[model samples]
Target: MPAPAISFEFFPPQTLAASFRLWDTVQALAPLGPRFVSVTYGAGGTTRDLTREAVATLHKSSGLPVAAHLTCVDATREETLQIARDFAAAGVTDIVALRGDPPKGSSGFVPHPDGFASSVDLIAGLREAGDFNIRVGAYPDTHPEAADSGADVAYLKRKFDAGASEALTQFFFEAETFFRFRDACEKAGIDKPIIPGILPIENWKGAARFARNCGTRIPDWVTDAFEKAERDGREDLLATAICTELCSELIDGGVDALHFYTLNRPELTRDVCHALGVTPKADLKNVA
Candidate 1:
């Protein structure tokens, strides 16, 4: 079977220097011809304006489809709906609806009493706001705050039932975990696309810490590979190899499309896409 198409995720820049880096990343990966790239909103909606601005820039300048992530952590229903309308008017039809994280230094997530209580609610709101292509977050290993894996799957199903066009999972290290999650979604009657979120091993220590916080497993072999490279200064080469192997294995396991968590870096994603034989569309010749 042929390799699947791919998408990518990028965060909005917090400063001018970061903005330049983000544009560089976009230029590098646009040649891969991702189905769409998503710009993440800040936790607790702190960077809502910045996120919208960045998404709009991508839409205007990149000539590639862009999805703006909208979260319901701190905004009122009216506020969230208004932002959705703004995106629609700005020629952005794809929305990644999410229940965002709590404010920094907070203990846990606390929902807005009159707003969405979860991602499912946010999906429903987006659907009502417009005829947008909505996406929601998923977790193969169960969300950290969920009661259990079964409950987490059920929640993801609810998001689909509410009209989400697809779900992008949290990054996972093991393909078996994704296969099991797909099985669960299939069994639950979720027919929408469930794309696996792939995170390349660029910074092993940082990635490991994040995986632990998000409940994604960190395989020993993955760590061992990075550990061996600690003395060689070949982390970039190793990152390329590890991510390529992971994606190749996933394709062999029947995955068609991937959503890469680019972490604002593109070389790794670019290399992996090359390895997978995904070429940029001809009209986009200047993307690189």
Candidate 2:
């Protein structure tokens, strides 16, 4: 099969050391020629300025297409749209529009009095405010706040109708999960591109917790394997193998694109991409 089109997700750094790490990550993965790389916002839009700075710096320095994550969490409607307009002014036009998580201690998402209430609303506002290639989130498994898997599909359709250009799914363990979700989306009359998100397990404990928090079901076998791998001190080896296998399976199943949630770490993601025949181009740009 042809090498699939690939993208990556990164987060803005909050500290000087973290800034170095983020640049290192970009340096490592940029050579792989990702179609685009996205920078994420912190919960409740806590890293709004950082995300904007990182997106701008990467756009200017790295010669890579960078997408900024904009959320309806703590900002007003005008505040949010102005950010999008600023990104456009900087020559960055791709956005991942989201209804972000509530603040660290909050019960759940509560829209700001003057903010866009939902991701769909945010997408609509972005559409009206600027010319952007907007991406929205999708849930292969049921979203934690959603009524069911079907509800997730219905909500995604609404996001598309509101003007999103694509959907990037929450990471899941099995290819079957994505296939089922794709079938459901098709049945629901949603015709947009849905790219599967892959998280190469960098930390078992953290990944498990994140999976639970996001309503992604972890298979018992995955837990058992990680347990054994940990005992044997082969966690990295196991992680690479598992991630490569998963990507191979998805390609075999006819998936033509993938988005990796790199979590600001590039080793495992780079290894997995190489294993899938995504190699560095000869003329890799200097990210320094």
lDDT against the true structure, per candidate, is 0.89, 0.95
Model 1 off-target regions past 4 Å? 284-288
lDDT of 1 by residue, 168-235 (tens): 99998878889999998899998898999999867888999988888887779888879989779989
TM-score for each candidate, following the candidate numbering = 0.96, 0.98
lDDT of 2 by residue, 25-142 (tens): 9999998999999999999899999999999999999999999999999999999999999999999999999999999999999999999999999999999988999999999999
User: Measured by TM-score, how close is model 1 to the native structure?
Assistant: 0.96
Clashes of each: 0, 0
Error of 1 at 282 (Å): 2.1
